[model samples]
Target: MQAIVVEQITKSYGAKGAVKALDGISLSVAKGELFGIIGPDGAGKTSLLRILATLILPDAGEAYLQNLHVVRDYKRLRSLLGYMPGRFSLYQDLSVQENLSFFAAVFGTRIEDNYDLIKDIYVQLEPFKNRRAGALSGGMKQKLALCCALIHKPEVLLLDEPGTGVDPVSRKEFWDMLQRLKSWGITILVSTPNMDEAELCDRVALLHNGRILAMDTPAGIRGSYERPLFAVRSDEMYRLIQDLRQWPGAYSCYAFGEYAHLALQQSLQGFDTQADSVMAELQQYLESRHHTGIEVLRAEPGVEDCFIASTKDR
Candidate 1:
């Protein structure tokens, strides 16, 4: 059985159920798989994770974790799952060690019993064991929260935006820790707005505007971007974007780093938009428009490029 199963889950809020948080989303995660729900804010990632964690019920559809219904068997499912929300929810007044011990006790397990599971992470916290939970740095607080979540050695782990507000180094370390945990045969589901992290997962589902735009391995998603794309650079970066977007042979254009990536419109009345024939004419067009030091070259599409293209309509 899959570690987690979500089938046509839908959720909404507000007086007349106006704001739709999730809309008919369905996906499953296999045991020992690291899956990512990739999207920007308000993409229903948290709602989906919360529903799987049994923190909230969906307005429609069913969800299961370890073959147990999330709503029907929440009591049993809770014990088999470890969930770390986007925000730090630890007790601020408690010491680091106290917070860990409290969560272990709540789950009917002693810290010593699970010491083997969290020793690597706990070592970093040991030096600050006496410090109040609120006194620790953002990264330390995240570590402590993770230790508490794993205190009982859950079968499935759910993390919602664990990297948000974390330093780049800490984020890298946290992802490394997750890779280590995966070796122990634990299923992990992580949600994040960061597109770069999506490539690290075994597979990802692109979420946008309360819906999934695409679901595939990182390479597969990049491969699906069928358009011919070019990275364009000129002295006037801002003006280049405006001109590219208005260009007759441009299918899609958007800013990417220092260049504006332009997707070619393959078929145009008088323009040969193919990569081989378009460069000279395109350069001349820019030159005619008074763009200096213009450089245009074919570029490989990354995950972010595919995402922008996928959700451009919505």
Candidate 2:
């Protein structure tokens, strides 16, 4: 069954609707699949997740959870949905175990009833079960939150920016747990501003400006870039950016980690967009300007590369 479905949903806020958080957004997820909504902050990822979890209604259009209308049957839908918002929202004074028990109680279930569902996660928190949630480290608190969200054995999980502030190792661990949950037949929809995290999903929707720029598997999105790309680096990074922008044949040059990925201009008069041709041109331009230790090689496009290209016009 389709686990979730959204149709042309739109949302706006502030007086006179000055802010449009979501714009004509529509998508779906299948049961037992891990789906990701990838975007940066203020891209409306949280708003879309909230609407799916039945926390708020859209200004236009509608959504569904497991075929149940989100607005009309929110009470029953809440029972079957697990939501971990971007923030650590558990009670500050409640101990890890107490918070777990409380959430289960609200769902008319007990820790013992859903022990298997959260055992792996809860085990890490077991030693710190007596510690107040606020006193725990960021990773630990995130784990506790995930445990609470799963206590009821919800069929679908909505996690918004769950890895935003956690460490790299903890981030990996949390995603590992999510894969295990998918194995248990739970539909997962995760949102994040991290471009690299797009690879973790079975499929992803690249969102920007409250709209979806592209939707496909990670490889599919990267493969959509229509120009030859290269990772170019010289002794001086800042000067390289300035020089590349003036090359006239350069399509886009943005710093990415230790190197800059440049998309050379397309096939136009006096310019050859072929990979080797563009590489040669870039090499000559940099060498003329006394650029030393120059390294220019073809770069395979990734999520970030595709995101920039997709958003170039929009």
Candidate 3:
């Protein structure tokens, strides 16, 4: 069964003329699947998540969780859901154990009652059970928050940017824990700005400016980028992007890390795209512009590259 459903849900703040936070968004998550809503801040991920959690209502359209309407069935919905907001919302003054126990109590359950659901994560926190939540490291705090969210064994889990502000090791560990949780038959819907994190999800809906840019498996989205892409770098990194974009043969040029990932414009009539020919032309153009130490090579496109290309126009 589909665990979560959102259809053409549009939400905006301020006046009617104001920009929307979630523009006609529609998506669904399968049972026991890990789905990600991938976008940067202000992409309306949190707004959509809140709507799905039945914490807030959308301006238009409908949303459902576990076959229950989010607006009409909010009371029972909250009981059947686990939500970890983007920010650390736990009481800072409480100890880890105290916080965990409190959440369990609120759900009408005890920690030991759902011990198996949280064992893997709780053991990691057991050593710091006495530590004040505010005193914990970023990663430890996140783990504790997650444990509390799962303490009730909710059928669906909503994690909003759970990796934000944490150390890299902690981020990796958090995702690892998510993978294990999927096996326990909980539907997981997570949102994040990290491009690499998109690949970890079973499927991702790419959101930009509250709009659904693309929805597909990571590979399916990346595979849609059809063009000869190249990584071009010169002694002047910043100038390289500007110059390449101005190049007659370049279709698109954007900075990716230390190098610029550029797509060269194909000939008007020919179906074949000669990657080497375009590279040779780019090299000559850079050389004429006195660009030294130029390195231009074909690049394997990634999720970020595809995202940029997909959203650049709209």
**Residue 135 error for model 2, in Å?**
1.2
lDDT of 3 by residue, 1-314 (tens): 89998999999888773979998888888999999999988999999999998888899999998999999999999999999999999999999999999999999999999899899999999999999999999999999999999999999999999989999999999999999999899999999999989999999999999999999999998888776788988999888888888988778998888899987566333424555676677799999988999998878788898888878756
The residue ranges of model 1 lying beyond 4 angstroms of the native Cα positions read: 267-273
TM-score of each: 0.94, 0.96, 0.96
> How much RMSD separates candidate 3 from the native structure?
1.8
Q: What residue runs in model 3 are displaced by over 4 Å at the alpha carbon?
A: 267-273
Q: What lDDT does model 3 reach?
A: 0.90
Q: Could you tell me which 10 consecutive residues in candidate 2 have the lowest summed lDDT?
A: 267-276
Tens digits of per-residue lDDT for model 2, 273-302: 355676777799999989999999778889
Error of 2 at 260 (Å): 0.5
- lDDT of each residue in 71-149, candidate 1, tens digit only: 9999999998999999999999999989999999999999999798898899999999999999999999999999999
C-alpha lDDT values of all predictions: 0.91, 0.91, 0.90
> What's the C-alpha lDDT at position 279 in model 3?
66
